[model samples]
Target: MNKPERVKLFLVDDDKVFLKSLEIDFLENADFVVETFPTGELCVENLSKKPDLIILDYHLNGIEKSAMNGISTLDKIKAVNADIPVIMLSSQDKIDVAVDCMHHQAFDYVVKSETAFMRLKTIISNAFRLKKVEKELKWYMNKM
Candidate 1:
């Protein structure tokens, strides 16, 4: 019997309190290894580590305002690895914004709220499963 590979996740948010809390929630699971970044710039800079999934805050505040926002971060991540799934997070629940994220290939868009962490966990699990299926399909296609 062998343990499954742990998923590496990058959580980028400007809100320190919320970021810390989310990190704690994700870390509770042994299957997930969550890394926190205060700015989208930092997250993009560390993309070489290749996180399995990224949870990015849409409106990165303060100093981060001058840096990359969630949409740009998603673009950068896709440039590095288009297969990587990025979940966009925002405190504002706007359908247009969510649509914009989806247009840019975001895996999902989630509004920041009390249940955000729970939603993130579910989305991450589903994303990983979908990724596995995609890889398997690609391999099969290459074989044929």
Candidate 2:
């Protein structure tokens, strides 16, 4: 018998308390090898880790106000590996923003709410399923 492999997840948020809480929640309950980053730059720099999923915050409250927001970060991540799934998170629930993220191929856009962690877990599972299916489809197509 062999243990199942843990999912590699990258979580990026500038809010210190919120980020810490999310880190603890996933570490406690999920079979994820989680890496937390305070800024999109840090996350992008570490993209070589090849995370299975990326959860990024729309608003980065870091010292550098010009740092990458979720959209730009998503673009950068896609540039690195278009196959990787990215979920955008924000306290703001603007329809336009969500639509824009969807246009850029975001796996999901989640508003930060009391039930955010639960929603995150659900989205993560769905994204992984989709990704796996996509990979298998690509392989099958190539074989034909």
Off by over 4 Å in 1: none
lDDT of 1 by residue, 1-144 (tens): 999778888999988998999888888754688899998889988999988889998887655457777788788889989988999999888999999999999999999999988888889889989988998999999999
Error of 2 at 119 (Å): 0.8
> For residues 1-144, what per-residue lDDT tens digits would candidate 2 score against the true structure?
999888999999999888889989999989899999999999999999999899998887555688887788889999999988889999888999899999988999999888999999999989878878988999999999
Q: Estimate every model's Cα lDDT from 0 to 1.
A: 0.87, 0.90
Q: Give, for candidate 2, the lowest lDDT window spanning 10 residues.
A: 60-69
Q: In model 2, what lDDT does residue 64 have?
A: 68
RMSD of each: 1.5, 1.5
